[model samples]
Target: MTTGRDILRVTLRRNAGAISAGTLLLGLYQAAETAFPIALGLIAEHTLRERELGSLALSIGALAVIITTVSLSWRFGMRILQQASVTEAHRWRVRVAACGLQPVAGDTDLKSGEILTIATEDADQGADIIEVVPLLISSMVAVLVAAVALGLADVRLGLLVIVGTVAILSILSVLSRRIGTSTREQQARVARAGAKVADLITGLRPLHGFGGNHAGFLSYRRVSTEARTQAVTVATANGVYAGIAQGLNAVLATVVTLSAGWLAFEGRITIGELVMAVGLAQFIMEPLKLFSEMPKYVMTARASADRMALVLSAPPVMAEGRGRPSPGDDLEVEGIVFGGLRELKFRVPAGEFVAVAAYQPGAAADLAAVLAVRVPPEAYAGVVRVGGRELSDLPVAAVRERLLVNPYDGEIFAGTLRSNLDPGGTGRPVAEAVEASMLTDVVALHPEGLDHGVRDRGANLSGGQRQRLSLARALAADADVLVLHDPTTAVDAVTEQLIARNVALLRRHRTTLVLTSSPALLDAADRVLVLDGGAITAEGTHRDLLATDETYRLAVSR
Candidate 1:
């Protein structure tokens, strides 16, 4: 199981090689940087000791030039590393997004909002490692360079600096493990809170109707507060680790200075050499500090990568068939058996209007899903034939291209009426679809008509209006076979009757399937299939079923 983190690491390694090279150059630059301060101390001491003014002045000038050159190289090298990190992070984000779209046919059990958060927040967090970790490694190399230079000035001071750095890093390594644990906990809490909030927002209308809106709000508030507290805990742990690393660096710097001064006083080392040794020891602390912080950041990224991997690995609901079916208008479900529609068989001629009126509401919805190939036959044994061939053997893309399923709960995005009606903009005009759906009344009421902007999920529209808009969208698609589930469920009896007549008239020469319990719709159907206990128990005209079938009459009478 090579995880998403593995993918991220491989991606970073491939792209951040340039950063590593630049960081190596920076390490060398730091060594040169350390040399300048030593050269200055020597020039000053020499100027005081034997009255060699010219030699000391030249040494000072040479040291100044070296300092300037090293600083420039260091700046450019860091810039290259920074650019490389950013590029690698962006690449990883796109790659992950592409991969996530795979296995799209299954009930991934992931919410849209959660996926959004993962793509934007978790993806970026995982990429942050590329930016910070490389620099931290380069800083460690800088510390090593300082240690080697210190040895040349005083072996004891060099040993002390190395030992102190090792101790601090070891402590940080232990602290990083704790931070990793806390970070994982915090991420989980945040995800849970996000999921709760998304559900509440989506179902806000239902909650209000039930007079439970306050309770739902309180529940979400509790989850949010818990998530916040966990985040603060993770932050506190990180802060403590950083504070310890910084404090250790400061302490080591002071200790090195005092030791170097004592050694100079005892004549064990020259004043200029002691000053240089102290400066190099203090330089050692900076890189050591960066090295200590890298582990925690890398750990946090790993945790987020693990979470994303779970979604990336989910099983898809349906799969693309191996063979492709020829494009045509004919559609059939042979021996199709599922949740409520079982052992059911039906067909829509190449160009004809066929309405499906089921006694069971669940059977109707389930049958529509099966016919649309939204649900897999593998879960519930069935065979759907499109264009006179088994749908299982037909490529899903080809099937979806000609077969459109207009779900009863279809969503409307926040956009102008024209955009919402033709989201795909598949060359279908808005005016024609609205007319076909009998939405002229709706447009007449709106001053903006086609240009009217809808709120999120068409919150501004009534239930019946939203249902009609969804129907308009399906009409706009102009697919060869259209499977509609309760298209007039939200409308009044008179409106339902009108829509039933209008729909049958508009789609007179097209292959159409409607799942309905309404008598008006059944009466308009060429044939009605009675589904009971997930099976097609009877088949006849609407009037015949009303005369003989008790279940059929009771189901549709309401």
Candidate 2:
């Protein structure tokens, strides 16, 4: 429930010390820079009044000290600011990444690409706010100090400097608001384009096979073009802002210099005061320009912070339970109705192998998600219990430890075969699971065996190989209740048969549920349940259903 402003406050508080130190140093640097011109004026006056080498050396020495201070202060100030900015970004990235990993209680509005962008680019932009505050403070300190020094030399000149600075900042602030609006639009458009590109890349192979590659490419092209247009608009606004800032600064500096020259001609002020006034005017521009640009950075940071807050504030789809589940193998669903399932009732006794062949493809996936605890209990009507314990009452960790639901399309990360298979590195032997999932051929093909490299999402492997590898990974978990959806769909009939036999043998005396229409898997089950129209229409052996049920036969034929 935290707001974007709260996020900004928290970040600033966390990095306050570093930010303060940097700001102090920057202010000192600006002070030293302002002193340089004053020193030059002093040198000029002293040269005219004393005409002594000793006096000239003292002034030159003072100027050298000022120059050194400016150099050192600027270096340390920048170091601190940059380090703080990066560290702040790292904190946000870690937080956003952790939030993304949590289970959502409902549908998520964010896409994978958008989440990635938030974690990286948006996080960095949010952190940049830490520098903005300090820079603005230091720039103001420089401008105010210059104005005071100018006033000390000549009252009118000092008033002019102060008035001009305020006017310039006010004009830029309005322009900066426009830039802020455009920048936010640009960021959103870029994120949309990024999401489209990511979708295209993830489904590239399938798109090619379906001859839909051109359509996807055209879609991405349209989104990318929009992003480009937005980017150009942002750039144009920024360019105008920068040009105005520089032009205004130049105009103000010229006015001050001309006024000082006229005052010296009128013999109203000494030559040294005139020199100092002109130098102060020129020096003021740097800080004035920085002051004018601060508003834009602040606005951009606010937009980025808002995006980050959206991700961090999302509610978890499933709440964690504190109660433990009983150690029993029985899984029962009584009158469950959710998504594509309606009034579905079923039970698989301890150590029983049951298959639920859903007529609709989406129904099977929805059923798997429900069993996997991916959906919250409140979303469904009835109850799912493990070992006679209501699933909602049992701790999520406890249920997950005992039951595993492997989806049809599982992700394969970039790593060696062994690492992907045994990601937890629990030291469980993979040989058994490998053999059970019929991945022996895949392992044998690579000379390195399980150590063979896998590309991202297993892109280097074939469809069958990827499916088998995923199956092997699931089997390797060694959970008590394993539910698999279409585990062998991508494999050949002969391989599927072998896999079914091996899976039955490996999981003998263990509770298992296979949600599939694969004949080999259905035949291997001790009992098969025909689920049609969101209900279990029939329950019998695979052969009995095929022989007596025409609807079941038609479904399995596909």
Candidate 3:
């Protein structure tokens, strides 16, 4: 359904005023250039032949005026066109990013790296259509003016130039179609190669130990090689197309020059007219070449627009809502029937710390999705409420404000340690959150303490360090309800116990849920619920459940 013409039409509609004014100025510039040789021909035929001083001076002044017009018009016209192109490109790039960042996941087949390519390179090329339109119009204006001037001197010359140009363009147009197909293929291949590199970089450390890096390299190399092959195919098509255009252009120029000479030898035109005809014939070559190159710009813009449209046209997966509940911290899930959950239900009063251990591994993620507001109401048979109101009725932003569902291995951005912990500086104190998450040693490891610079995505930090920092960042948010899924997966047993104890003490008055089977966190919880066979089958304090229920003991120990 995405024809890619949508982006092109929208871009043109928004910049209509700018394009009109810029094209007018550019047309004037091309007209001025066309007039230069005509003025010389007139001065040579009248002023110099008369041998009169006043006429020569006037002719020189006229030539100076024409030169000044050419210089000024070209300078200002290009400035306006270039500015519009840059601004339009920036606008599209930001629009693409905004679409990708929406809280409700969109139904898109594009991967992360492919989206990045579309937002940056594809946007930039598509905006070149703005510049291409004006330039193409100006080139046509130059050719039209030249033909008119030639016709005034000799009718055959004008007809021949126009007819020959049409013929050459018709031939080149067919070759350009082949170029368009190859260029589009080249763009897709490059995007796939980019996706491979992004995947490899994301898991670089883990991949390095298991020869995954080598396997990824082999995969990337194949994609890269395919991209290069497509690039070569595109290059071959363009070369053949340009070669034919130039060859035809040279033949047309040569024929016109010969015809003008024959007419002069037959005394059919004056000497000055012949000079003008020859000069105009030579000058027309540039405008004709401009005609030949326009197809390449059109093809590139169309291909980029197609890629951008893929991202922009993706469908949103959740309903748009603006409803919110009255303020409270109570969490409730009743008759929740989702994937693998058969009427699963649970509740936690305000200021309670609870741990959920699921025998079925996927059960934990199902619970996280419900609390995180990731599922659409129409897609499931359940009602999840916070503060006595349904989650589906509330705006996604409002839900996020009330409950922070920190995912496993949460993302880390490039910044100082303190900035990573409290990015907005609106959360709980950095020292307090860091201490509670057992990240005190990380601060001490760097002499600058919280000021220590962290690499992008914590690439320079160990997995355990990244995990603890993720925990610390979430702890600082001060949300009404907090859920941590497998927060201690990467840490040692001793460190996990300390983190559980400190987190429990720091969040004593806040509602918190730990969705993990880690023994340290489970034992530290005020109460533990065992989820098995798609429902909560047993519930008690961790020590009591361990002694009383064999299923709870086995599941937690796993």
Question: For this target, which candidate reaches the highest TM-score against the unseen true structure?
Answer: 2
Residue clash pairs of candidate 3? none
Q: Write the per-residue lDDT of candidate 3 for residues 1-558, one digit (tens) a residue.
A: 445688988888788877887888888988888888777778777864797889889989988988898898888888888888899999999988887665445557677778888899999999988888988999899888988888888999888889988998899888877887888899999988888787777678888978788888888999999999999999888888888888898899888889888888999877788888888888888888987789888888999999888888765446666788668888888988888788888998889999998888788888887677666676678888888778877877877888899988688878988888888777567788899889999999989999999987788888889999999999988778899999999999899989999989988978898899998899888889888877888898898998998877777774
* C-alpha RMSD of each candidate structure in angstroms: 3.5, 2.3, 2.6
Between 1 and 3, whose TM-score is larger?
Answer: 3
| Local accuracy by lDDT, each model | 0.76, 0.89, 0.85
Provide TM-scores for the models. Answer: 0.86, 0.93, 0.92
**Candidate ranking (TM-score, best to worst):** 2, 3, 1
Expressed as tens digits, the lDDT of each residue in 284-318 for candidate 2 is: 88998898889999989988888888789887656
> Model 1 residue 293 lDDT?
79
Which candidate, 1 or 2, has the higher lDDT? 2
lDDT of 1 by residue, 373-393 (tens): 667658777687777767777
TM-score of 1: 0.86
